[model samples]
Target: MHIDQAILDKVNPWLEATFDNETHRAIEQMMTTSPKELEESFYKNLEFGTGGMRGIMGVGTNRINKYTLGKSTQGVSDYMKKAFPGKHLSVAIAFDCRHNSKSLARVVADVFSANGIQVYLFSDLRPTPELSFAVRHLKCQAGIVLTASHNPPEYNGYKVYWEDGGQLVPPQDKEIIDVIEALDYSEIKFTANESLIKYIDKEVDAAFIESTVKHASFNTPQADKDDMSIVFTSLHGTSITVLPDTLKKAGYNNVHIVPEQAVPDGDFPTVKSPNPEEPEALTMALSLADKLNADIVVGTDPDADRLGVAVRDNNNRMVLLNGNQTMVLMTHFLLEKWRKAGKLNGKQFIGSTIVSTPMLMELATAYGVQCKLGLTGFKWIAKMIKDFPELQFIGGGEESFGYMVGDHVRDKDAVAATLLICEVAAQAKASGSSVYQELEKLYVDYGFYKEALLSLTKKGIEGAQEIKQMMIDQRVNPIREIDGNRVVMVEDYQSSTAKNLLTGEVENLDIPKSDVLIYYTEDGAKIAARPSGTEPKIKFYVSVNAAIDSIDDIPSAEKQLDEKVKAIIRDLNIN
Candidate 1:
């Protein structure tokens, strides 16, 4: 196949510019021997997505490499200087266990240092959320973490955080992109000011762990903790740096770490994907739990921001709880803690996403604590905290296995979330209830909600267009019904509007605009369609629920909800 001239136009500069000889040869090799890859590599420049700029690490402008990330850092540096003038600009830098993450982080630090900004670079790998904490803790102007979260081994990423310790949001993200677009590759500052670069690890780690323990630990007695065995696996990521130590400090005795997956490795050799959302990722942890007859099993993604939990059910079988289930569980436990202490005075609120189980709102309502909904990513939840200064942020989570316990870290934090979940399990067991049983009780009280996610992976160039067309098709020809249930309303987040199918009335949606759509069924079923911001796929979220009579009726109710989700998916005809 011939390489498109448009693609060649984007590629030629790498060969002729001030780039090194190695870069030129790599581009030349791709042009001659790998036309398809060359096309995908040079089709367009990588831009900030839902999480931030993330892609497979390689040589092209579209890839995550020294030059590409350097350019992004340059843009951020420029934007930071403009955003905060006459102040000494500084940034905190951290990286996960991804290949070349350490080096990539150094490059980012160099760019910021060369721009006369102070750089506080971690000497070793750290979880993504700690980077958020370090930003605010160290009093830096901004922060950057080099990680792709749960993406496969080939991927690495650059996530920017503002001074508030949250991921970069609207105006700043757009402004930085605009600055990056107008720059040439040669304009990236590659020189480092050694005097301005400081290597920090132990002090910040201590502060972060201390804060995490104080916020996440609710005084579950050491004897109560000792009564249960807990198993944890980091999935070959950065959580190993803090989770075990924090748990130990919090007085948990019987914690076992998956031997093979405990150490941080960029290859993520044990699992097919490092994502904790996938059940297969926790297989080793579950096996270890069974061997030890552990009460709970938990595993974190590569970046340690998202976590998956497994708890023993009424039948003594270990079961994996979906993201929604975990979210509701954690939120309920936190709310209960607050209620017992008389902290839920209606001035505190928790956060959930549009695709999360609606049971979170119900649980919040039971305590009279407000629950705010945001778009997909945790960045918006962070924005909610900043948006509502009058209200206190108790906790927030999404359907993708990410949760933040309080306003400390500002993003989805597994370091603290790990402790929070373990505490919930410990406390429940102390009360003769299990996490699984408490979940059923929540269903009994607030209603039973079941959720499933379908991700259709579309590869390279054509896949991008296909995903785009899929969302377009969803809007142009909206879902009207599913398995005899009538569609009562259609929500188009891209247009920031909701149309009532029954009354034909359109009302504006009060959220940031994005390329997403949701259909509400008459029976209260909701299905949302959204394209993956950082990956090459479109995702469909299915949620169905019904009131349960008692805890024993959970199995039957969930079976019905499962079939309802399947029928809805089938009626939508989404493959």
Candidate 2:
């Protein structure tokens, strides 16, 4: 079954002739020195998956490089031509502060321009959401952002967006992938039509800032901006250029930026990873907060689509709130403000992914606003907006600190989240209450919901097979209990069906088939399992909730939730 060495030798010469000089050199170097590495890299081509191409930057087929980027762009350009022939094609391009990000963006721009597509390229780094916004704002046919989001510093990515400002879905994604698979080294166009590429910076920046600031309900609630000291960090990426000014414009004069992490550097020298989801990345901000007695510490990842916030607890120590908790607070705060502004019409609705805490649905139901649940990705939320024209999507978020406030953009927007969170904090401060106190009030009003996410990464070729087998095992024999709670239902997104464990009945699920499963308990506790789309990880999402009558029960209630999670992990045999 093994291929002959003679065939490989023959194919190697073809590869050298086909690839560009840099790519050929990289491939030759790896093949001569690290044969195993070369095979792992070039055995299979870089694929356009659910979120497009993302991987570590290196010289291999599996890694991201100018050649790979050019190939993907060429495929997309070719598809655009066939999909919309005899029409003027336009695509917007943006990037983050990752290594070689600007260079990659320019390469992509050149490829598109060479294909005779008009390009709207950002002159400087911008957030991912702004790229989504720009696609719609400029009426372009499609868009691209050079960012790996909250991934580690060694990684970079390229995300594609359609004219609707959402990532391509269904048929388009499949068609694009097919076209990319059919392409070879010769198919990629490297020549640049400089005249066709337009560099845009200040115009979009001003527009995005204006739109984000308008989302703020109460800008200046406190008279003394100096009293509310805040420390902010960009984690050595984008957001420094506008975030500080945005805070100042929102009437916060005493905001401090983390000096070591302020400048836009791709190396991310101050932190091991650029992800704001991890506490280590936010260490600089938290340290500054502790030293300066700041009210809040905020950090945004490289592309600024996700946010991390730390608030002072009763013990006067900074506590980093998880994604679920932050989303809950923002949902509560925004709904209240909208209701007070007489903006909560009957058509107003809020949304979150199925894996998010059910607290938002409970709260929205109480507020007379509809709570719509979508699949994990923000594109599904965008799909909902397209499907339901009557209902206005107020906000949507995942448990990963990504949130979107309005329909202006189709992706998770950290800028809007930043504006809203600060406004919420300012209002709480003006009322002489802490943000934690507001969270406690929400818990009391809408039941205490505590959720935890456990992600197990299985690396390399063998790891992928292991993850696949695990999914098969779970589907065949489902977990029936967690801490003695009776299992009520099992929602398998992959099958697009919900199984009634007791009654042995099945019902159809409305969403598309995805490799995700959720087990619901009779008492409302839930556990969800899914393999990550981008990384080599299988994630477990656990949620446990109880009704709280008073603030004093927070300790016991939290303990119970913790025990439930631990028990579930034990029963599930997760490593």
- Give the alpha-carbon lDDT of every model: 0.92, 0.84
* Candidate 1: 10-residue stretch with minimal lDDT: 473-482
Error of 1 at 372 (Å): 0.8
Regions more than 4 Å wrong, model 1: none
| Estimated TM-score for each candidate | 0.99, 0.95
Q: Candidate 1 on 186-244: residue-level lDDT in tens? A: 99989999999999999998999999999999989888999979999999999999889
Q: For candidate 1, what is the TM-score? A: 0.99
Cα lDDT tens digits for candidate 2, 366-389: 889998887787777777787789
Q: Single out the weakest 10-residue window by summed lDDT for candidate 2.
A: 1-10
Q: Which stretches of candidate 2 lie over 4 Å from their true place?
A: 1-14, 217-219, 222-226
Among residues 3 or more apart in sequence or in different chains, the pairs in candidate 2 whose N, CA or C atoms overlap within 3 Å are none
Native-structure RMSD, model 1: 0.9
Collision pairs in model 1? none
